[model samples]
Target: MATVRRKCFISYHHADQDAVNQFVRDFDQAHNCFIARGLGEEMPGDVINSNNTDYVMAKIRERFLADSTVTIVLLGRCTWARRYVDWEIQSSLRRGQYSTPNGLLGIKLPSYSGSFPERFNQNLSSDFPRIDCYARHMSYPSSTSALVDAIEEAYQRRTTHQNLIVNPRARMSYNRQCQ
Candidate 1:
C-alpha cells in the first residue's frame, strides 16, 4: 500500500490571505498538501468586524486542529499583532494530541523591509521556530523545493521527538547500557 503524505495546517493573518492563498496553491501543486483557509462556509457580512475576532479565531482553531500533522504560521508584518493568529499559534502549541518537536514553524514572508514586526520582537522568547521564507525562497533554485525542504526537516524533527517519547525504554536503554 502507498503511504499518505502528511497534511500541513497553514495559519496566517486574514490581511495576508492573498499571499497565503498563492503559497497554498503553489505548494499544493509542488507537493502533496492541504490548506484550511476558505474551506468552510462564508462568513456573514455582519460577522466580518474585528469585534467578532474571538469567534472567527475559534472557527480557525476548530478547522486546523483536526487531522493535520503540521502547523505552519505564515508570518507577515501584520501577522504577529493579529489576535486570531496569536491564538492559533498558542492553541497549536497547547494541543497535547498534535504536539510535535517543532510544534510550530513561522515562515517570514517576502517584504521590502527586513525588520520583523514589533509583536514578534516582544514574543521572540516563545518556543516557536522561525525561518525566513524569503531567504529560503531566494536560496533555492525553486521556492517549491525550499518549502519542501523546510517542511520535511521540521516533520522529521517532530517525528523523531515523538518516537523518543513513545519509546522511552529505548532511550533509557541507550543511556544506561549503550553509553
Candidate 2:
C-alpha cells in the first residue's frame, strides 16, 4: 500500500529548534512524505508571553495547529520541563467545537536524556493492553519510511483511540525542573 502523507503539527521546545528544523528539512521537504507545520523560529510574542493559559492555548490552536491532523513532539533534554510544551500537548489532544483532537506522537531527539514531557506521557501508554494508549513515543526516525509509518499510525489513532486520551489534567503554570 502506498504511504499516506499527513499534515503534521510539530510540538517541540525552542532549545531543540535546530534539530527540529533538520527533521522537517529531511523528512518533509526532502522526502515529501508528510507536511510539517509549526511556529518554526518565530515566537508570537503577544500570545506566548501572556500570563493567561486559556489565551495561549487558544492562539496555539488557531494559528499553529488549525490545519494539522497530527502532532509530532521533538523531545529534547529540557522538553519535559517546559510549560509551553505541556500546553502544546494539551492543545493537540483537546477536542473543540471547531476541531477534533490531533493524533499525538513523541519523537526522542538525539539530545533527549531519558526525560519525557509530563503532559505528553499522560496520553502515552507503555503497559499491557496497548490499545488503550492514545500516543506513540519512539526514537528519532532513521529513514523516510520510518517517519512516514509513524505519522500514519498517529493519524489512524486520532479516532481509533480518541476515547483513551487523558488531556484533562491541569495545565502546568510554570516550568518544572527535570532531574
Candidate 3:
C-alpha cells in the first residue's frame, strides 16, 4: 500500500504573504506542505486574477478543504480584523474535521520588534476550541524551529490517536487503562 502524504493548509492575511511564503518554503523543504497561494500558480491567468469573491473563495474551499489534513493559521498584527482569516478559522472549526491531538494548529507570529501584536490583546477574549495556539518571535532564528517543534508534536499526537484506533484492544488491555 502507498503511504499517504500529510498536507497542511496555511491561512494568513495577504499583507503577511511574504513571511508566510518564507515559512511555506522552509516547511516544504522539511516536510510535506501545501498552501493555497502556491497552488494558485497552477490556475489560468484570468481565474487567478478574477474579481469575483465567491468564485475565489469556492476555489480555496474546494482545494484546501478537500486536500489538507491540517490547517495552520499564521496570526499577524491585523490578522484578527481580517474577515477572510476569521472566516477561514471559523469554517475550519465548523467542518468538525481537525481537532486537538490530531488537527488544526494556530501559530502567533510575534511582531518584528519581538512583542506580541497589539491586536492579539484585543481579541484575547474570544473563544477558540479547536485551535492549538503558540507564539514565537519572527525575528528569532528559533522561530522556525518552534514551528517545526509544534508540527512534530501535533504529528505525534495524531499518530498516537491513530494507534489507539487501529488497536483499541491494546489500549483497553493496558494495565493503566482507565477504569
Clashing pairs in 1: none
Candidate numbers, best lDDT first, in rank order: 2, 1, 3
Runs with alpha carbons beyond 4 Å of true place in candidate 2: 42-49, 126-131
lDDT of 1 by residue, 1-179 (tens): 43245566666666666676667666664454433333312211222344464565566555555555556777765665555544554444443553442234567766313433332233234325853211111221155556656666556655543332211111111111111
Best by lDDT: 2
Give per-residue CA lDDT, model 3, range 63-152, as digits (tens): 565555555667665555455554444333333235332234556555322222232222222345633332112232355445555555
The number of clashing residue pairs in model 2 is: 0
Cα RMSD (Å) between model 1 and the true structure? 12.7
Q: TM-scores of the models, in the given order?
A: 0.56, 0.89, 0.52
Clashing pairs in 3: none
What's the true lDDT of residue 152 in model 3? 51
Model 1, total clashes = 0
Between prediction 1 and prediction 2, the one with superior lDDT is: 2
Would you list the clashing residue pairs of candidate 2? none
